[model samples]
Target: MSLIPLARLLPRRRSLGRSAAALAIAAVFTALFTAPAQAADGRISGLGGKCVDVAGASNANGTPVQLYDCNGSNAQRWSLPGDGTVRALGKCLDIVDRGTADGSLVQLWDCAGTPNQQWVVSGANDIVNPQANKCLDVRDRSTANGTRLQIWTCSGQSNQKWSAPGSGGGDPQPGGFVVSESQFNQMFPGRNSFYTYSGLTAALSAYPGFANTGSDTVKKQEAAAFLANVSHETGGLVHVVEQNTANYPHYCDWSQPYGCPAGQAAYYGRGPIQLSWNFNYKAAGDALGIDLLGNPWQVEQNAAIAWKTGLWYWNTQNGPGTMTPHNAMVNQAGFGQTIRSINGSLECDGKNPAQVQSRVTKYQQFTQILGVAPGGNLYC
Candidate 1:
């Protein structure tokens, strides 16, 4: 890949000369690498760990648990019980019907080593069901906690949290977090939460002008970082549509000169980047030359639009010219001084600094997998 190549994937502006230093930083970020142990295990950690509840699951001696959340209870305190059972508070984490669908639910059952019943913990802290060689997963890490756990194709990421028994300082609840299925789609298949490998393959086949560019290697690191950040924002692409759209309710109802409509009016923020508000719609639309309000859902339904919105936020809102996205992360604000910025509140909340920083630490795990240096910038 050329250090400075053809037209950038997204538009760039000159007024943002302030971003030049940051871009320089991002460009040089390509030298970083992943942890050797984690690489060997195929696990990555950075997304807030998923909380599971062991409620109703059996844990007598060897029974496994159906993964759930910790409502500040002991049932959720799971550890690896003797044999294959996941011993928590006092229960084990068992597989349901021994079935492993890249995205099916995980249930607690008797202590049995049926193929689906066995599981693996990777260096990246990802829990994998030995039966399918896939990681445990959640639908989308939906804001609503206590979501069900399932088995899905694996992609080492922060959302998939695990802990080794011998490792000192391990969380009392081992293997509690699982990856979001949508995240898996974005990584191996979608080319890092932004472009789909399938889509790229089809585009290459259909468009003679489309070049593999072999740029995948160059962008691999950046793509990983971008996906991590997005995972943090969208909770694993559970709501792809809302994850990429703009916030609604243009103005605070009481503050608006004209009262805003009720109900549907508040459903503005949608998609991965959560595009919201008439102003944001106009801004994104004008930037991409699309009429967003006319079709609010376009941002999520169209991959091109989705990519554009995310990239636009990266350029316009986060860090323009900062190709690597490292500096832009700081914009996440108190979330962490390290996070350059965030496109939506769905994840960062733009308030909790500790949570934001922790997420950045998780994003670093993915970036490391792709050879992106911590605190370093990346470029063509």
Candidate 2:
């Protein structure tokens, strides 16, 4: 029951015979998955890598992965000998059977886990086959392109050192595990690329108290949910388009000196949440150390700054001792604020205010799903 068309949105399924073969392979994978290994995160050393279901990272079958200190974590659990060839979560990773050259896409498939899905881990952090002689390599070292896995020399670079890093509780670091620019767009059709820079990831890693809520389970769920909602609102990670800006410019005056700049301001919306208008742009710049008025495009250029603006808005609207602005549809309520911000901004015009019932409806919807008040922790 997806919004996009099935034929366009999903990959096709395999035939019956292929399905049986895949299951047989699954039996073998399951046996391996349960066996004790030198590096026990349920991972086998010197052969296959682990699988984590994070976005813009691992693909279905032929997805390239790396090795790390194994802990039998779900992110690391892999099933190689299964009905489908390369799989995780009971789905397969597919390599274009007759793919050409080094950058061909490695996609997911239904496992009949065949030779294509079967990879031999050679040396440290290298997926290779003594038979094939080629090792797993990412094409052009371009994290921007989707998962185009191919056979290259066994150099064992970071690009080749992939792991199925699982998502568990607490807030994921600002720039945690992300899909490469290429893979992000491929996985999500009609979407801009989602790339997480190393700096933000490192920063988030350091600020566990603020980034993660201290619970791995809740953190993972919240991270996934947050990414999904924000991606929908921001038009992927690029903020390339502003679908909700017709009414919700959040400006005091469109014609005022401090309104939107003639060429910019409301022209294209700035920052991650795309703060628009002269007032908000100036405010965001002041708060986040960027002069949005002087140079509006910086919002897209510096991802960390873009995120800072979104966080600033969120904190200002909900942080302690702060008053919620009339322009901001969502504020001071936990998840409710996120929902209201998303829902209300979708319909608000700078001239007119956000509809209360619309925001309330979204809040109710989120509450029902999350089982708590929206923005609950932030408000109190």
Candidate 3:
């Protein structure tokens, strides 16, 4: 069971039994994750080597954390078990009493796993509070004992640097794309079970650049923007097809060279973004290699195909706007541009503020859950 010997046995695994090889791999993982994490039982020292200490050695819920001399006191003993919290005296290092602002003071509070309690030790040695997008800073840059700590704009100043417990381990972030499956459900709780998480993830392969072409914040912002617009399109993914049956037959335009072979009423709005027009079905079908024009019903039938049709329009078509929704997000055009790209002419420029607000509200809520700020220009 000793890792040292098991690790040595890994390189010679071709000669070992299958059970031995599995054990060696297990040993590797155990060593990687079970090692004593940094700051597991250490004092987090900042400017002037002072420990990040809890005031008065209190275990109460609202105790203020302060800069104090490194006495190895119980108050200075801290543990960061790599779940985004700096723990001491059985409470979490928290942003207390005020909103997540630049000057919010730090405290010890109940470990609720909220964004206010999340901290990440970056490569620059600064402890960042993600909700406010600020760093754990020394108030007034003071090294004096009892100087309360606060979250401030990170300038990479010496006072902002700290030797904390872990660097790469923190609260769970977006693993693949910015929208995790849990977050997707929260964003669309009324979504049809057909719009499975597996379907969305599988569709990501169709558009290689979507939600994957920007910084972490930008990635999250783009995801929020996309999901918000689609939420409007599908009524929170609750509808697999357009409701009004009267407009169903009108989506087929006879002017196209290849007319609606699936009949006039076949190409109704369907899927996440709803491929409605016959020409649109043809285009999406060609791009996705799925004969959607000939068989428009496929969008509502296959979950992954449904998501792919949605991604097709989002990444390629501009609808009534100048840019695709994908380009709007990755190119720094803001969420407003995405709205324009999705349905701007009808909803943009004060024509339908209520509808625009609906999308913006969802985008804001999704971004909040993703632990990122929603960027500006949210309205079309």
Task: Write down the TM-score of every candidate.
Answer: 0.36, 0.36, 0.55
lDDT per residue (tens digit) for residues 319-372 in model 3 = 677788899988888999888877776778998799889889999999998999
Candidate 2 per-residue lDDT, tens place, 18-67, comes to 23453355356546533222433434333233333322344444444433
| Error in Å for residue 125 of model 1 | 32
Top lDDT hit: 3
User: lDDT order of candidates, best first?
Assistant: 3, 1, 2
Q: Which whole-number lDDT from 0 to 100 does residue 276 have in model 2?
A: 55
Task: Encode model 1's per-residue lDDT on 1-380: one tens digit a residue.
Answer: 11111112111111111234533543353233222232112112222333455545344543333334334355555454334445454334666655655566765555555656555443345565544445666557442455566665553333344443432222222222122234444343322333322122211111111111124432343345555655555554444533222333332233333233333354355444555554455566666666664555666554445545665554455431332243334332222321344522222335445545555665666655555455443211
The full ranking of all candidates by TM-score, starting with the best, is 3, 2, 1
Q: Between the candidate structures 1 and 3, which one is better when assessed by lDDT?
A: 3
lDDT for predicted candidate 1 compared with the true structure: 0.42
Clash numbers, per candidate: 62, 58, 2
